[model samples]
Target: MTNLRFREDGSFRVLQMADIQDGPNVLPDTIRLIREAIRKADPDLVVFTGDQIRGYDPAYIDTFLRRRGEEPGARVRAVTEVEAKLRGIKRRARNRVNNRLLAMKSDGSNPDVQQTASTASTTSTLVYSTTSDPQDVPTTLDELMDETRDKVRRTFAGFLGPVIEAEVPFAATYGNHDFQCGILADEQDGIYREFPGCLNPVDSLEPGTFALPIEASDGSGRVAMSVMMVNSGDYAGKPEENDAQYPAYVVNPRGLDLADSDGYGTPSPEAIDWLGAVQSELGERNGDGKPVPAIAFQHIPPQEFYDCLKEVPAWTPNAVEGARTHAGHCYVLNHEICRPGSRLGEAIGCADENVGEVDALREAGGYFALFCGHDHKNAFVGHAHGIDLGYAPTCGFECYGPKSRYRGIRLFEFHESNPAGYVTRMLTWGDLVGRYSSNEVRVWFEDHCVTGAISMRNELRRPQVFAVLSGAMSLGFMAVIRSLVKKR
Candidate 1:
């Protein structure tokens, strides 16, 4: 474990990275963004907010093994132990896709729908090859499973390499997709702990729940402030069961239907109680019997995000849709309460159920800010009730983000004398690398495959692309309205 302390200058800087969400073959642009952010921030500690790996890849046999009630560790390494089960899962998934295509084809009246169905049917098995050399391809189910496990390890190393090389201590919290590929959160936690600079706790109220203490600058061993890290679990429940609680508003960046995605989860009650306990313990130990100041970090935002949002018309510029109880309406940061420099480009994908994190923190009395990262397109800080709720936009290029220029990291600086008066800023991609990169490439992973594309040099400048798209959409809408008026 790495001990966190204020620098000799009485200052500490933290770099937050969220949703790198890449696979074995990580994108070049993603690496560029991360390296540049690390260099520019020169943070004392790095925090990964989750979704480090794409867990939905078909090659992940561990997910299937776990679903079948089988252990996936080295003890169960025989191919025969899982070959039948893996084949069954694959067959069922393929059948479901083919059945849907058949149903669409049966309705020959809609030629457009039929055409789409046919195309999907033909490309159903076109998985992007993760291996560069044909000889590296696995020839057996056992080999495939081994390759998949290796891929997950490689993915972690690819992203964490920079922090490890920089000798900066780092901690992490898991996101919804992190465990989907077969490695459970606790298992992934083990992998994270193997690194040299990891600060993950060996014991906590829950896995991935721990605290980092910043020691006093005056050579006092007393804690000056505490950075609380909590896990915002995988999913509340299946989509069908919680549809009313978390309405799917927009398809995710990976193009997965929102309706099919599992709902986001919130911190467990024990985790909430753990925060209170930390507050009490710290107060007695160092704060002269007063609660120590703290700033919390989690993977998912609390429901209070809606409380700080003001609804607006769908057509309102820069407005994003609301989720869960506030679905069907568009919202922007309520400037009356939110600080300046806040931006919301997409809906808040909060948990289906309200776990009362905000209320708990408000009542606890010392937490000044809460920052999260599940929603990739939002980067804002809002003051609601008594605490500050904020999001650090995703720094990875593999997922849906605000344009290329806006994708970046968030940095927070704290002073030993006054921890509660800490300051933070967003170091965007445009700040480090130019808004447009000659090397900026389209990077994304699908449920079944991973593919990458590079745009022609300077062909798709971020601003011009969006401007043209907006103008074209407006003209098309106007033409449709005119035709309807003439018919009437």
Candidate 2:
């Protein structure tokens, strides 16, 4: 068994932020709230789950191009002119030969023929240039990448400052939105593949399961917290090669493709194998005699619970077009063979036989916590096998419609004494906190209080008594109603 130990004390704080897409006015407000939260929480580590910015919109692409002075229209026009000149030369050569042949056959007496021939040649050349050759469209993916990186850097700097400056060590999992190739091919090729800085620093560290030693409050104890960041996308033969099945597996309702060519999301099989090795190396050791608690962070949630239980429209005839039904969960099968299916389960590659990579981790036997942020909705703590899956809220903006509410983050604190377990709390911000109070300052404080209470209850379990009391009250009310109905 690998021994789990913290370099400092056992207690450490973690902040989970998700889905902060960029907008002019919305960005600043979101950033302010994030900065305030960081200051107030003073978390030891911050984890951004995914979707850092909305980079898919064509308008965003246009705006970025305009900013760089590489507008497509001008480039296209210039290329058009060049092509026209080349075509004009070829047309004039053909016309000269044709006129010579006509003159050779007609006698030298037709002066009108010369004028008509010249006019015909000019019109033909102009028509050929205009209709046959088109100008090349100009799009500098490299420039776009540079702009994106600068924007990301500025945004991150404003929120996180320099890592060294903040003196806070952090780790991140590449979300579906973070990896460019999966979202935009040109953007991925230029920014992510060619440019070194475009890739998130954390991505280069280690692909699989790893342990981070965090200090306890007294600084006398340390806790080795296991973190597994896996690629939920499809897999091809090798991690380096893009999977071919990526375009088929769709996770986002907004029609975002989260898979590479192999259909894996981010970490890839190379990363998955690396993670497996890390877990194997860690074994079962917990710092000081407790079991090591492992947390898996990813942009998307496991398909089994989130994807399977949720309601979706049915397209089949007689299925009640808009009726809701229980669908099996989705999972990644062999990365090489994912195909589109008739059902959602088949669509996500979660066939009946697929156990999923995450399941493999849970089966390996250590206290495991799965934290995700793609769903943008609150899920009651759910347990599958032995793993506890917790879905966190998005920090970027509010999720409107259905269960509409304000945006928030999840705060996780792990203690050294209990290495196998950790406390979790939800921190709401912006309009979410506003729903509770009209005063902005009061709302902030109140939101903090609510979060603090949840955290305390998670750790001590003392406040659960209130939950039990509430349940009992509801039960009593139901019993009285039943008795009164019987008497009547």
Candidate 3:
């Protein structure tokens, strides 16, 4: 019932994908890069914006109880070097679950499992065991959240089973390692609404929000865009105080940091006042009386993404040499101007009294932009005055990026008569790894990407017909580069 409006020539395409962090297992090169980002962005919508399920490294139960609370042969050699790295990760998780149940018994696709007796992976039936005294470890955090909640429900069903076997359409948002492994963003959103185009399973919204409706059809009155999801959940919360005024608040004297041992989540102030009451309910009785062009998906980053690094000029001198210096560790005020790796960002990471939820999404007028993915080598886009701030490009080959850029997936081509216009592109996994692929991720999408300009939706939207089609494509690309430089 929510195909999300669109018809007046409504051409919709959205796909973001972020910080994947699939855990306990989901690597077949991250399911061939989520089946090549759903086979080159064949999307009508698919946004993730959060570390999709990586919960369960409660810091080896807080560094094995703060290194076995010291003393006594240095706590039995630090619990025997954390019980020999948990028996070498339960013997390489039982030889990777017996080589994926002997490759599903040589691809007979599990006809009643018999990979030489000892069933385990055909996806994963959670076997990979240990602790029957091979020196044991996990001394509670409820035995490391019941041993990583069955490999985060078999790596979140092997990372949402290739976007529900390519039935695509999808939805997601609670990053900070999706509730840090032990699985519970309402049980990974009830296994993401049993799949098939799950356009938000609505758990009564607002505890991480959701809102689709991008109008162009469905009783099309107009209103052509509004995507929003945002959960941005990180560690704890309860932050308040910092009458915000142009970057100046720092009080995390090591307090209730919700979750860390790698489990990021932060976007509080009740997730920025439920994203300003759903961006002021996208006007016109939520249909199309006008003013409806929005985009927001979260996993942390707000505080005006540090006032959009002093207004983007190719990330403003790397945000002024990244402001100052790292204080608590990662809460950005500095350090991240082209961010390389190691989860950087000192802290403008939304939550501490989130500036009246970005002043009610700048007095809510179909917001503008604010996509996110918790700094995985930041993808840049800044801008604040008329609102827009971005980041999305961390496709999880485990995390930590940058290599001539392209962790891929972040495309958008909206247009249906510009309900606030749209256009964006970035679809790399090095364009599906292997062999030199073409369209090199739209030549690296992000020339301050915020696309959409087919004469801003027809009618030759005047400007002297865009200066006579930009002087006839600048004299037909200078007579085809001067006839190939006069035949060389």
RMSD of each: 12.0, 18.3, 23.9
TM-score each candidate. Answer: 0.74, 0.52, 0.29
Q: Which should have the higher lDDT, number 2 or number 3?
A: 3
User: How does candidate 1 score on lDDT?
Assistant: 0.69
**lDDT, candidate 1, residue 74?**
12
Compose the digit string of candidate 1's lDDT tens values, residues 1-488.
Answer: 66678889989999888888876767777777888888998999998887787665444533332111122221112232344355452311122233234323332334355556657645545222323554543232333445566778888888888888888889988887676555667767877888789888878667678888877777677888888888987665543453352222222223232333445677888998888888888888885877777888888888888877898776555565666566667777798987788887666888778888888887787799999998887888888878888898877776656667778889999998888788888888789988764434442211113211212111222355457877999999999999999999
Rank candidates, lDDT, best first. 1, 3, 2
- The predicted structure with the larger TM-score, 2 or 3, is 2
Per-residue lDDT of model 3, residues 1-488, tens digit only: 45665544667888888877755666566667677777877776678777666443322222111111111111112323454476454321123344334434332356535543544433333233444656543232333445555556676577667777776667777765465333446655766665566776555365456777666665744455778887765643222221231122112211212211122235556656766565556564654444467777777775567654433222221221221122222122223342232122222344443445556676766677777876655666655657767777677665434432356667777776764457676667666675322333432332122212321322132345456878999999999999999999
Please report the candidate that would top lDDT against the real structure.
1
Which sections of candidate 2 miss by over 4 Å? Answer: 1-9, 23-26, 57-139, 161-166, 180-211, 215-223, 234-253, 256-267, 283-291, 306-355, 398-405, 430-433, 436-488
lDDT of each: 0.69, 0.43, 0.53
Q: Rank the candidates by TM-score, best first.
A: 1, 2, 3
Model 1 residue 450 distance off true place after TM-score fit, in angstroms? 19
lDDT of 2 at 428: 62
Better of 1 and 2 by TM-score: 1
Q: Please identify model 3 stretches exceeding 4 Å from their true place.
A: 1-49, 52-54, 58-130, 133-171, 174-190, 195-211, 216-218, 228-292, 298-345, 348-367, 371-386, 390-488
